[model samples]
Target: MISAISGSVAQSFRPPAISLAARGTESVQPKGSDSGKSSRLGALTEEQKKQVEQLKKTDREVRAHEQAHKNAGGQFTGSASFGYTVGPDGRRYAVSGEVPIDVAPVEGDPAATVSKMTIVASAALAPAKPSGQDRKVAALATSIRTEAQAELAAKSRDKLSGKDESDSKSSALSAQAAYTTGSSPEKGSQIAGSLLDLFS
Candidate 1:
């Protein structure tokens, strides 16, 4: 028996940071911290400029990653939410983001469950660089798909067996009728041949 589908939360690309400044600068004030406080009014130092660019790149990647999930997931996913970090240029950038997706299996319909799980797994892996949490969700989806496929196979086997049993009963009735009617040897042989054909 397959286990119940695990609940999947939003998958984030990275952890949020307070700032993108260098390690030692967190507590120390910059040379002109007061005057150059606003990013629009001051020329950024070389380090600050580099940090800003890095933040911008990170922001773009995070948004794009979440967007991929949203696009593939469609109605099953919620809007992308971001975790922000203040850059050295006094601007907020997205350091991490997540898109929540529905991962529950379809009830009572293994075929539908398989279809839904396929989509869920695709959505989980939609991003170019899938996070660990994303991979976990995809794995869960695969498990669900496997279980549903087994169920569908079982149903097909049950249907075929029931049909075979009905055919066997009909063939037995025909043979019994031939015997009760005191049919000719040729007719009895023909009925036996038919029964053999049915079984074969």
Candidate 2:
């Protein structure tokens, strides 16, 4: 007896579906809608708004320096300083400036990859003194700083370790190039062995 598979069974091994939601889309709101107003309720106040605008200017300058330092493979060192107060309306405000830092790569290897990033935040406060409402503001700032440092430190370690895979590939490429350039078979084997040992 002979058995045959149906076309539908063969077609069952088709490619998986693709989702297009990953691409961004522009949303259009209908006329006379209240959705837009509610969306902006948490924005900074007039005084805070002015302060944030000033912060943007400082941020641009710091970013420029940070980028230069990163390109040169150096360490990034910067500080954010601020003086702030709270108003009777329960809003805390402050003026702050961030000094840009130099970023450098790890020492020893000239071709070592390095990455540094910095952002400067500056602002001025309308009421520049501590109050009950300001207490919460201080706490919030402290929380943000702590969490941000922790996150950055973790992410940095992850990024550095992830480079190991790429470095192994680079070593393999170097060994292949050396072999193709008339190096002895023994030397090429040694190079490849060293490359494999890197991740080991």
Whole-model lDDT values for every prediction? 0.73, 0.36
Tens digit per residue, CA lDDT, model 2, 91-191: 22332222222222224322221121111111101123322322332343334445556666777788988898889999899879877887766876899
The TM-score values for the models, in the order shown, are 0.74, 0.27
Q: What stretches of model 2 exceed 4 Å from their correct place?
A: 1-126, 180-200
Residue pairs with clashing backbones, model 1:
none
Lowest lDDT 10-mer window, candidate 2? 117-126
Q: State model 2's lDDT.
A: 0.36
**lDDT score, candidate 1:** 0.73
